[model samples]
Target: MSTSVVENLGPTVQNVPVTEATAAPSALDTGLTLGAVVQTEGTTFTLWAPAAERVELALIADDGSQRNMDLAHTGEFWTGFVPGVGHGQRYGYRVHGPFDPAHGLRFNPSKLLLDPYARAVDGTLDYSSPLIYDSSDGDSAGHVPVGVVVAGSEPPPPISRPVHWGETVIYELHTKGFTKLHPDVPEHQRGTYAGLAHPSVIGYLVDLGITSAELLPIHHFLTEPSIAARGLPNYWGYNSLGYFAPHAPYSSSGSRGEQVAEFKAMVAAFHAAGIEVILDVVYNHTAEGGFDGPTLSFRGIDNRAYYRLGHGGTMYDVTGTGNSVNTAHPQVRRLMMDSLRYWVEEMGVDGFRFDLAVTLIRNERHEVDTVDHPFLAEVAADPVLGRVKLISEPWDIGPFGYQVGNFGTPWSEWNGKFRDSVRDVWRNSSDGVKDLAYRLSGSSDLYGDDGRYPYASINFVTAHDGFTLRDLVSYDHKHNEANHEDNRDGTDDNRSWNCGVEGETDDPAVIALRKRQMANLMSTLILSTGVPMLTAGDECGRTQHGNNNAYCQDSEISWFDWSLPDAWSDHLGLTRRLLALRAAHPVLRQWHYFSGEPVVEGGRKDLSWIAPHGGEMTEADWYDGNLRTLGMFLAGDALRATDAVGNALTDSSFLLALNATAETRQVVVPDASWAPAYEVVLDTSNSMVTEVEAGATVPLAPRCLVLLRAL
Candidate 1:
């Protein structure tokens, strides 16, 4: 017996080794490829089912003809090779084993199982069809998608001009939602991979000054039966089904294996444009829900091995999903590592943002341990994966899951605290000034002395899971009735402040206030000392009708509305200006924590907190719960950085003042004469620029921000 040309290299899918003793009876033994591995002569299909007494390959022909072929089992793997089968061949596996759901051994031969390592799958899943769960043989063949035998192809060369972490700006978006309604994209190409890679889309991102595009889950996912039956769709794509394959629906071409090439082409295009592609991956769990859920690939192949089985076979889910992937298991870890490498090496993606990543770092007993987790250490040491960016959601629903700042060096995390604290200050909460100061200054309290830089905090005031910047000031409560969960599914603690009304209103005063607040949040995010991730459509005020959890609203509720509102243009312009300011000022994105100590002798301190009374902030001023007025002085001459060409960089010293109260506050500049004159760079209240004399008292408007550059 000879091993297949393409053998399972990374830790074997099963405990079986790639030796002649563990090879199938056939001369061409495809050892543990675990899917339809297409060859020049034929296609060899393999599956891992250790508990199966027998396994059969059901090949569905192009003419809808069904051919059932027996497979030879050697150790834990079953292999079968068909001479005539070639690329585009559709097939699935049927395993015969014990079917006791209570004991977590569910091997129903009647339920045609999908290949867990399928690179491409044809057709869509009809969850309601009986063939999906029970044996309907030929009757079920049309209802369920079959794995397509795709020929291996090399990916384009890696991006040469990768964005550095210090200067990277992330734009988080949904693949379909981002361009689904863009006028520039063709109707046929809208919401497709081709559309996203279009020159028009690329140009918009470049103009927005975002170095990377962090897409929400684009992995092949299944729409939950409950949500689909209710006429709603899972717009977020969090429910992953096939980890190795890109979502076929996102491609303009048919699902007959063209999606793989289309996805790769999209990555290549982004790299060509010098923009990095970051995928928001969902590996914490699969679409297969709780114990009674559908028998998907993982559940049918190796239920006890792939998923964490709690007391008496019940799933110990930490991701809020019913079944959590048993990452502690060697085979499961291999599956994840292989999938990740495939995306980067074979698909050309630059990085990944793990959703509910805390679940992946848990021990075998389902205990969270960021320091000692085998997966974390493996990722840190992986030569291929270590070079690419690795971001973690940093929290799950389990105990000790909120390990935000606990991640080691080289790993950044979604700063949930930054989002909350920023919201608190603008909402005019008591003692919020201190929280705002901490977050705006790189969240030192969270990442301080942890061997991580300011970029470790991926800061955003609004994300896809919550209200958009527009809705934050428009709705006092979540109006998620459109989700069909009676508005009870989303979190009630929104921390949002409606300008004056609960929902949309015509009052000019309320609308004006809301616009100002949006500007405030955006300014704080870009000008702060950390990496900023702007949610798609947030710059143009795309709203979800107050539905924070628009995960299931696949219609206009989730799509990016290209038809911009009147105020949305202003919003977009403001965002562009603020990002431009961030790009110009290295002091705003300092790599090290500011110690209030001067870098150059006789120079100003790197940073200093200022009170409204023209003096440095005192202990008593910081403790004032009602203090809503604050100012910060940034020393540009201190800690100067160099450009890529090794040329020394210079920036202007800046003084930023904030007045979150209902009345104007006079902010006095320090009398130390850091600069002879200060020019107002931006004012959120008026969206204008002016000039002020040094040591002058600038009257900042109520609930507004003023940035002044020393001249």
Candidate 2:
């Protein structure tokens, strides 16, 4: 059975893939299971390729032997059941169809395509050769990865207690990089899923007081041909090829299906330590890349049905990668939802942090769909996905892509605004406290009216894409010459200050000032009213050596330097202290936005901004550009929350003071009406914790943050 395709893979969806009369069959109609499903008798391989006239499963033996079996075509799906076949078998598919690229049909029988739903994958793309490209019908069997059959598994062990929304603290880290150089991790396990779940790793997280470990992309991904051709590695793993399979190299147990078991065990370990695992997923695009790239999985199966296409059969490129996924496609949506459920139900992962999430909701016309988009709506309605932590990077590189706070209701967004504002303040480049005030208080202007609370803002100063916190204070500009792109690839608009010296200076005073800036940035991130996300080693002086964009450098530039712990104890200690404070104080991690209204009769405002003088801040103070020294007061009694047992939740009110100016500033504590007295709890200036009398003035050093508790 064959079908004529559209002349061009353009914006129009009507004439794409195949006609609507012969579209891919719905699972509800056929009840046909997809992918290689293991049964007691044999393994059945089912694929959805409506346009293909012939479909064959290419089973590869470990010794490079190959066998091809024809799949029985039925209702737009092809099925092949092989008896005596079970888990650990490596296989791919050969789809025979029209080879017209102009009509979005670039099927080549020679290119052995992987199953999009492969539970595990083996081998990497041989990017050194031109034959890897799907340009001709030349054989690509050995060049691309093959799918490994995963065992039919038992239900994963359930998490006893997941962290609640309001009190959750996120620690983002690259799985391999986080433990690659860890002294305590086993030699073999270092830089694998096993390493991330090592006892010392889990113990460190528990000790640091973070409830969630947000791992960077773990999906089976490919090094871009360009990056790989340049002799650089795709360290970030954002170029996703297999969503169901974990990256093979990061598997210590083996990739012939043991990687699945190892990943499940890793998640279980984290759950046992009272920490939830959050995956950074890239569903926006696949590693198949643009028209001139390789045929991995999605491209060979059904090109037009899987990817968004532009005029003249050109691929619609968003996500700053090559191709934007066809989020409007029903089967594509099903695949995503299935992958998500597989991780949560079978693998026992707690949550997912979607990369370039806005692309996931683009409509058939390639426009943003915020209103009841099928994918997001399905996620919100799914009993499994809805309950877990749902976070979005929230934007793509498409038209009108920077929708930071626009992802409404239950979706927490990476607060890029918070990072910018905090960086500006600590670097003393900010115009005033006006924008910083908005960010420090959860960016109410962004999330307040949308029925969202403070937690919706995932406050982060440094993440995988940018400079580490240490480099944020050390590099005045991005030094990405190591990326091999002549330093022109990374963003030049880094709002970083080098603290009177550039890129690792030996001057003690400059180093000290950089440390203070690091502390100030971290302190603001934690003390701010949001879900604070700490970049892995930000608390312990991790530096990319001025390479803001270290996505391709998998060497020491991207890996965490475990040796910094002993050397930078003060910064690490300060981060731990701030996290402890956030865990203990309900007022700090408020679920509700502050109204600034009185909590009780004749009481002070629930929250207030303070002036240099011992008085409430006037409008002029917020607008003044030179007013770097300021204070934020949170009234503990105004939390208006209760425990599960229904008892009223109340605690001591606190004040956070900031001095970003060059000189020491005196910040006066408010009288007893706001707090009985204030005591320094955590000081970025390395000041000792001390009690301050009511209405007393506390000295704040330059580039320092002081958190004071009510006595």
- Give the top-scoring candidate (lDDT): 2
Mind giving the per-residue lDDT tens digits that candidate 1 earns over 361-420? Answer: 888889988788889887888888977888989999999889889887779999999998
Q: In candidate 2, residue 349 scores what lDDT? A: 86
All candidates' TM-scores? 0.93, 0.95
> Residue 140 in model 1: shift from native, Å?
5.0
Best by TM-score: 2
Candidate 2 structure quality by residue, lDDT tens digits, 1-711: 232111212221111121233655664456666788988877878888888887777778898667776776666888867887899999988888888788898777777889988999998788865656667546776788999998778645766886888989999999889999999999899999999889998999999998999988999998998898799889998999998998989999898999888888898889888998999999999998888888878888899999999887789998778798998988888889889998888888889999999999999999988877888788878998877999999888888788888888869999999989888888888898999998989899998978898899999988988888999889889989999998898888889999888899889999988888888888889989989999889999988899988999889998888899888988888888889988888989888888889877766678999899989889888789988988899988777789999987887889898899998887778887777777788787866448888788777787788888888
Model 1 TM-score on a 0 to 1 scale: 0.93
Worst 10 residues of 1 by lDDT: 1-10
Q: Which residue segments of model 2 deviate by more than 4 Å?
A: 1-24, 601-603, 687-689
- lDDT per model, in order? 0.82, 0.85
Cα displacement (Å) at residue 123, model 2: 1.5
- What clash count does candidate 2 reach? 0
